[model samples]
Target chain A: MKKKNICITLMFSLVLGLCACSQESDSDRPERSETEVRKEEVFGEGEKIKLRGVYLNGDEVQNDIMDNYIKKNWTERFPDVEIEWEGTGDLTNLLKTYSATGDLPDIWYSDAASATAIINAGNQLNLADHITEDHFIDHYVNPEALYYSDGGIYAVSSGIDAFYTPAIYYNKKIFEQYELTEPETYDELIQVCQTLIDDGITPISIVGTTGWSVRNFLFFTILMNDDPKAAQALLSNEIDFSDERVVNALKKIEDMLNMGCFPEGVANIDFSTHMALYAEGKTAMIATMSWGYPELETAQDTGVFMWPSSNPQVKTGQVLQIWGSSLNGWAVNSRSENRDLAVQVAEYCTEQEAFRHAAQGSSLNFKTENPAEVTSELEKERMAIYNNAEQYIKTLHLNAMDSAVAAEFATYTNLLLAGDYTAEQFVKDFNPIWKENTWFEK
Target chain B: MNKFYTKKGKLLFALPGLLLFSVFVIYPMIPQILISFQSHNGAEALGYVGWNNYTNLFQSNVFGKVHRNTYFIVGCSLLIALPVSLLLALLLERASAGVRTVFKFGALFPSVLSVTVIGKMWAGIYDADWGMLNSILRGIGMEQLTRSWLTNADTVVPCIAAAFLWQYIGLNCILFYAGIKAIPEQYYEAAIIDGAGFWRASICITIPLLQDIIKYVVIISTLGSMGMYAHILVMTAGGPGDASRSVLYQMYYKAFSMSQFGEGCAIAVIFIIECIIVSIIINKCIAKEPIQY
Candidate 1:
């Protein structure tokens, strides 16, 4: 009887303790909407408001030069609005979890592919509501780039990103050792791969596990046939998946696979391993995006070129570009208690990043003061590719599609690299998947 | 004290555990069931879409493959893990103290290590260019046998199952060892007097008496294999076209990766049913009558 009384007393105390722990302290609660002011007016005066943020590249926030630069500069500009940032390598999965729980961070870094899902979940704030005058959207090199599908500016751009065209970054020393020049066309590239293979070297390595790299190779090949029309048809779902051009593109990739272009077990090779293969001189070439620039720069004697075209009519200068509408940037949580302050933090982060990128002479969709001069040889060459390009075509299939469609695209592409499907089977299998997921009207 | 012995007071003792179970498990399951029948985008239910998610799951090209892979993994755990663990336990029972200690530590080491570390270690072994498996094949003059293990559909599921089995085999063996230690020595001595060797003793005495322990381990192993996600995530990520994907991995991909929460929940419902059915079967078949000393 004494033990039973003790047990009841302990259980009640445990429940009470849980309840006590859950109650918010007086200090933890936000300052609330006491001060409704204009964009220029500072928020939370004499009080600190800490906003939690999760970014795609937030995992390395401490080591990130750009984030640190933004943090130091923003601290001086908005001293009261403190942001407690957390980084994640897998932002999409993180956001999905948060959105389900109705506990999204104050700010999150999102790209075009992921923005639709967040907005559909009603997690994104329409920046237009908060900033009526001097809106950041108006300053964009292309304002439409930041607009949500429903015609509201949901995200603010940090900088104008270059169209993500997967380029072949090669080991210059290896090329020189074999006396090989950069290949100019499909057949030439194949012949170059053959030479490398015969010399007992893998010609290329890709982030095959992710699926996007192989998809880039396929889409770029299709764009080679007729850049703009093919991109538009695919994006708008006007062209069927089993179209001759599409099937032909898949065959070209298959031919490369047959020609011993990629590393053994390419489908399991991740981004870091793929990069390491080139850096370590195990593979002669790597096909990846401009994001590979930093890693490639670190490697000695690395050179870059666009994936060579297959069609006779496709010119040397034609290249794929991510349009302004699909640029990645900062988004404020619509459901946040500190929505007003969150919007301010997001805007400050965006403008600050854009300014820094501008100062660095990187791509900018918006105008800024005193753009830095490009001095590095590699930077000069990259700029030359952009300048010399006949047209900047948007590859909508990869970038501008609904998030689900993009995910399926990656899955199917991974399957293709795995030898699970022939080119014909791939298209037949993917056609229904594409149709099922796509939101765009024909 | 006498008043506390009443039925109402006795039921109060179970209240806390019941409350916790209701709040954590039973409460969430109600909404999950509802969501499985609705069109959800992770955040909230959009509308009723009865049977759509289930129909889609059945219709999906990768669905059949994931199910088959899941069953294959469970089968491996049952067929390979059970017999091998029992054999090892029997061997350990007869071994000297030092050998027993070494064997025990060796068995539990993989179980205690992080799943990520084990998954990654296995991935490295199966890597195509520089992996230990391919290197061994090459060294042994069987270069033709050196194919990418994780990426190939034929070998991918089996490779993952091998890793999963390798992780839990030792722990299961330890459980069997404990059971063996509990069995009466007189039975074994009586068998020895009847000219029974180690094999016959094990077959007749150890196997029959260890039914209860075997049943428990079999159920746990089967259910654990069915619900596995992390190893697949770290190794192949349900890739090479979802050829190596399990039911849990597919649910994760559908819900988190693609934000098809409705479909994911439907998978969860089916998974729960599958687990319950499997547990019932294991209970019925393994130890119909509870064994007593």
Candidate 2:
């Protein structure tokens, strides 16, 4: 009975105490805290500012080049700043959780997706206010376009980017054996797929079960052959997703599905199986972003073709538009005391000498005209893809559209493959999600 | 005054714990509840919107699917996981002392493994195109039975629940085994002497004595299954579409991925109410039980 009484008393006290803590205080706080007084009185180097930052994890491409640079150079370069780095596989979620608690890091790098998220969370610091030409921000390729809006620059790009929807890597051995030339249009690609299917080999390997293991497959169909201006207009909200052009792009994807271009149960294949199918010479072609180069390189004599567009007028090598996003952009916390220093360090991290190491090591082309030297055949192939293209525009995801539209479209990847949802259904189901989000407004 | 000091001393002893609980658990709820009534993304508090977030959630396309999936997973835990665990516990309890000890130690092994590792192993099993599942199906000449388990919306939740079952079945078995051990052996002996078999004795004596243990298992399993996130996240990542998302996954999607913290907080408040109901049930059930013997 005594033990029960103690437990009841304890529970009641906890409840009461928690209730007391939940109440908002009506009393005003003093403008200056004791810590501020101490900070103001600090001597040399402003009390050694600790710069908290996040970077991509081990599994990502050549992040070691940047981390190595940081390890060897950054510590020596900035003695006054104590760098507390957290290398994470999940920077976006970490930042979201941190933003909820008002615990933003001083610096964080992302594919400039962080800028949208940070600005949405009201934590981004506009770099245009602090960074100057002498500071290396001007050195990045089209630095102005990196910002979502003309108002301010929230992210500084890494000056180099890997092209998405750049090419379809095919097995040169298989192409030679079949007497197949590199495909120049969707029809020709289908002819190749049909030939491979006739030969009892899967034409194009895809990873569907891994939730977007083949993410680039559909969007590139929409954007690849289209003029950069039209894509730009769409991204900048000059047109809606319901536009005929967008629907037509979606229809092209549905057409490809109808052609039986992919393997049986393509939606359920794992990433390893997808890779093995392509690498082990079971599949003739694999369409993917530049990162798949290392895996695709495993095949004997890999041949490359620019992702063929369905538009006949926009013939082979005529459509030059490459999918572009700010590959590695770092944003600083607006409220951090080390905001200025952090911004300075962000620019410094991406300067010519060090960033080239990252770009070359990661097998990416630099934004600078005199970019890193081509070191391998894959590097040479990647360059040809980039050089062949006339212009580059970001996918609809990274630009002015609402993010919900992107997520909605991402879910439809399965439905498109399964033939459950039509292109008309996509436009019908999606327009409301897109329209409800008043982009560039509250 | 001295009596007051004695009570105050006990309260003071609990102050550290109370402060930690208030800061970590209670304080977060204050903001969440306040924000649930407001139109705020994680960025800024946009003015109050009375029940609008809640309305928006129900009105979304995937809400019904998410709820169905969540309830389905919970049902799997209750209908499938509970019985399997109880059977294992009964067998372990009936085992010889040395064998029981060995089984008890072995039961902890799966629970001790990381959820992510376990989820990945099951994902491999469920994978199509030369996966263990399809291979086994083909080996036995049952190749027609295999399908793409994770990608198909119909089977994704079941596959994920299977992963959870693999993890929790052993854990709950150990828990039930401990609870069953506390049942006085003489009651079982007397029941057997009165012409009761193992099944009859268990149904009549052991189960009646296990009301408290059963209550604990049901609540934890139901709530834990309802909050399923990491396993699903690792296995399916909430889709070939959002087919596998539980309510908490939807909350995470809305709050973090979509940056709609207002809706996220509204979902959180809903969960808080759910937790309150769970607590109410627990409190109501805490009345002293009559001895089975």
Best by DockQ: 1
After superposing candidate 1 on the true structure, give the runs of residues whose Cα lies further than 4 Å from its correct spot: A1-47, A58-67, A70-75, A129-132, A135-139, A216-218, A323-327, A355-361, A366-376, B1-10, B183-196
- Model 1 agreement with the true structure over B1-293: per-residue lDDT tens digits: 88888866776776677566655665567668989998887766689999999999999877888899999999999999989999999999999999999999999999999999999999999998789999999999999999999989899989999999999999999999999999999999999999999999999899899999999999999999999999998898888977888999999888876768899999999999998899888888988997675
Tens-place lDDT per residue, model 1, A1-442, is 6577656655665565456435344368555543244222444356666679876664242235346666678779777666787777777777767776666888988756556667776778778766545465666666666555566877776555554455778889989999999887877888889999999999988888857576655555445544556655675677867877777777777777777788877888887788888888898988776656666768758887777766667765475554334436788887676777777777777777767666666767766778787655666676677677876665555454565666677788888888747889888878887777646632
Give a tens-digit lDDT track for model 2, residues A302-340.
877777767766755555434545424667777666556
**Interface Cα root-mean-square deviation for all models:** 5.1, 4.8
Scored by TM-score, the top model is 1
Q: Which candidate's lDDT is highest?
A: 1
Q: How many backbone clashes does candidate 1 have?
A: 7
* lDDT, residue A49, model 1: 62
DockQ for every prediction shown: 0.33, 0.30
For model 1, give the RMSD to the true fold: 4.9
Which ten contiguous residues of candidate 2 chain A have the minimum total lDDT? A24-33
